[model samples]
Target: MPCVKIDMIKGVRSPDEIKHLAEVVQEVFLDKFAAPNRDRYQVITQHEPYELIFEDTGLNIPRTEKLVFIQIFQQGRSADQKRALYASLAERLEKDCGVPGSDLVISCNRNEKEDWSFGYGRAQFLEGDL
Candidate 1:
């Protein structure tokens, strides 16, 4: 399973824009990452303009209010697959949501299958109830 946490600047995007952004991200996972619908776990958090901190991180990319951070936690993916997923996320989000790759920071943190508890007070991946 993959869970995405999207953080963006508050008051900069309309409600519709945020909703569409989440949709675009989910579509990328479904189409490019091949994740199942049952695996969807997406959360969006808005921060005041000054509350969101960012840096060039030596990439020399300038910061802007349009910046977004997509933190993904998941298990079972090859390096090549992860690369493709990142590329597709940048491309699709730019094309569909008008958010450029330069303004986005996408990171994936791999975890063991036993780390997730989808619901019902169970670790479905280990319990075989998924």
Candidate 2:
């Protein structure tokens, strides 16, 4: 299963946008991981630009624009699969979400059989949660 988390500016928050992002992720998974349904993934969006605090350290945190971060975890996928997935994801995300690839940070975590729980009480995708 692949889980994507995006952190962006508050002004960029929109349900429709998130829905599109999820759809893009689902499409990528289907083509790369052979995941049959969108239920195999989790996508979370966080509005963090308004809350970033780094002034104390003299580090500037840009608030005028948004920086998006995507983290995905999937098991039983090959290296080629992961590479293709990220490549597709980055392209689609930039095109569909209007977020530039340079502003988007994506990470993929691979898990072994004993490393993840996708069924029953674990983290299976939920409908209403979206």
Candidate 2 lDDT over residue span 86-126, tens digit each: 78877888788776665666677776545544656553333
- lDDT computed for candidate 1: 0.87
Residues 29-83, model 1: lDDT tens digits? 9877789976689999999988888887898988688899999998888888889
Which segments of model 2 are wrong by more than 4 Å? Answer: 50-64, 118-130
Q: What is the lDDT of every predicted structure here?
A: 0.87, 0.65
Q: In model 1, which runs have C-alpha deviations exceeding 4 angstroms?
A: none
User: How far is 4's C-alpha from truth in model 1 (Å)?
Assistant: 0.5
Question: How well does model 2 score by local distance difference test?
Answer: 0.65
